[model samples]
Target: MAREKRTEQLFVTVPSFFRCPISMDVMKSPVSLCTGVTYDRSSIEKWLALGHNTCPATMQTLPSTNTTPNLTLRRLIHLWISQADITPAISKQEAADVINGEFDSNSLTKMIGFINSSEENLKFVALSNHAVPKLVEAFAKSDSMRVLELIVEVLDLISMENAVREKLNELILKSDGITDYLSSFNLVLQKGNTESKVKSARILELMAVNSDSQRKIAEKAGLLHELYSLCSVETETSAVEAGLSALLAISTSRSVKKELIRFGMVKTVGKILSGYDYSSAVRAVIEKSLKMLEMVATCTEGRGAISEDRECVVEIVKRLMKCSRAATEHGITVLWSVCCLARDGTAQENVAKVNGFTRVLLVMQSDCSSNTRLMCGELVKVLREKNMKSNLAPYETKTTHITPY
Candidate 1:
């Protein structure tokens, strides 16, 4: 009875082709060699690295040792694994043990597999078992890059739970564990690949729930800079948004806002806005950028940076009434800061140059909030006055209720 149960659990009926010829295990990363024979990438690579020029299974003389990924076979194996009613190879207790115990790559891989198999169940198990804190502990102590990446991937998965998220924030904000976790995250941000960076940024954003944590997170070396670097339009939209959301979380701090300005966030945001076309996907990024600009504009340096960037100011004006209501409000707030609050004459003139007068009026005619309408009034008055001085054609301001602050 015990032997039958073990055989049933072992996927004894797995296809011969699915197993690597050398390792006799199901191929995790199947690759085909020059001899048209497939083997697990790691197993074959290890064979070739030993100075053997022939295929391991067929002993065929290799023209070249280059291996191509057998994507079809890999997909089939994945589908079979998913459909098979096989029990989890790693139990919840085993996962907890691996995470809490000393670092083990093979065990970690099984833990990752178990978690990936059923994330919802594992989330509860992780929370109950205090898996997040253990993972953080592992994340800090691990020196291997692959191990660190695996740890981050698991953390990202479990972090979807609110309790798990709050626990992570506590770890970041707690004095005892702050250095280890923060430095580890900064290392990942600096050294990890794009996916890892995105995950780390998102994790940081989750931790930055309020001002205290945000300020603390911003204080970490090169963390803000790494986040800022991920905001390019050329990168994946998810990465760009992850970077922006992380910065936005921390931007409430005046000091952090200054750091962002020093890192050239204003110009980068403007360049992104200038280059991106309006798509459903890009609209969210635009809104977030405008909102961050508005927050930064609250500071004198931020307002100055926005005003000095001619294209940025123009893009700010162009965004009015073009995106969502929230985006329009943010754009107006940014313009109001530079033009009215800061009394930037150049920004006022740029507004007039972009036909911003018409856009602001369009905003006013829409169902904007009462405060936004008032800002529109002030913007119109400023632009009109600036245009009059510059001998530019004046817009007819009488069509809407105009009250200048």
Candidate 2:
């Protein structure tokens, strides 16, 4: 039968074709794609999804049904790869140092294309986690933003075990060059346009889950103008959300918060709250902004902590006044936090900055969100030290969302 002959040929020519073009490793645990190509176990899964029915090299159409092996290819791959020298010349401890010492932007860019077009190269990187040293070294010193991006993509996609989270944390802490990597990376954001913001957003999200990511970025020895810019982006909800969360983490460093407010975090958040392309996403952003601002307002004195011009307060008040029902809920929380911040030393000066009490009363008089009303009344109760006062009448209505064009 033709199928029998094809099977024989597959076994015969496999010595030459056993390597995945994408990963460049002997195709172990070979899984046949519907496209009629057999690939490394990890990668064939991807090929099958794209509806490819032929080998890229042989152009043979793969059968759509009934190709199951009595033995799954994982065993085969395990056998083949087990024979491979996956064992590092150096211990895992040296992974950071073993990375390409001269990895620059151009090299990283080339690697990106290679990783995209060839799985073999990706396999090499994945198998040799030790080589991360080379990548980090290159990204750390390079000025090209794209390299930083490519390197991050590779690290994130590589399979890391949840059990090893603690070990990885320790390893990263021992590793050098992360700060340099982020510093050079942040510079790229400053020079980049809209696309740059997108890249930074993704990087932040990926790093957000990393245990030491915030500390590493804060120590990166770069100005945060780029992060601030991403936070301000109005068109992209993903970028906005990532940027805000990134700021929240970075603000843990008192010095970092100073720089962020200086770069205009409050105003950018205000713009996001004022109106944007998506209400659902915008409201979500407002919630994050409220939470982040609460954390920030906690650590610093009113005058010493805020930007010198009181821009943050004025901007927040404006945002609260203009926010819709969803955003107003968060807006009130922020306002309440600010009210407390106003209470300590310079209570008069702080209150004077935004006419804190009046702003609270305005929300009480006109604001509709029940959550907002309760919070305003609470602030009055706290600040006025009131005892059963009738002047604190509350308004009850629903807030509206920003209308789309």
Error of 1 at 47 (Å): 48
Cα-based lDDT for every prediction: 0.77, 0.51
Which tens-of-lDDT digit does each residue in 1-405 have in candidate 1? Answer: 553354334433668789776544568789999778899886788788889987755444588999999999999988987776444557766766776677555555566567655534556546765577777788888887667766776776566567888887776587588887888888887787766677788778888888789888889888788889889633776578789989998878788899889989899999878877764436667888898898899899999999999999998877776656778899999999999999998889898887788778778888889999999899888887877788886666564342221
What is every candidate's alpha-carbon RMSD to the true fold? Answer: 15.8, 15.1
TM-score of 1: 0.74
CA displacement after TM-score superposition, residue 13 of candidate 1 (Å): 28
Clashes of 1: 0
TM-score of model 2 (CA atoms): 0.51
Q: What is the lDDT of residue 177 in candidate 1?
A: 81
Q: Any idea what lDDT model 2 has?
A: 0.51
Candidate 2 lDDT, 1-405, residue by residue in tens: 453344323322334345554343345456654544455555555655577654433334445522343244556555653454232223223333334445644344334334433445455555664555555555566565555555654454342323223333344445664555566557656665444455554444445454356666666655356666677744665556657766675567677776776666655654554555333325556567666666555555423444333555555555555434434455566556555545543432443344455556666767367767887887766545421232442332333432211
TM-score, every prediction: 0.74, 0.51
List residue ranges in candidate 1 displaced over 4 A: 1-89, 93-97, 232-234, 394-405
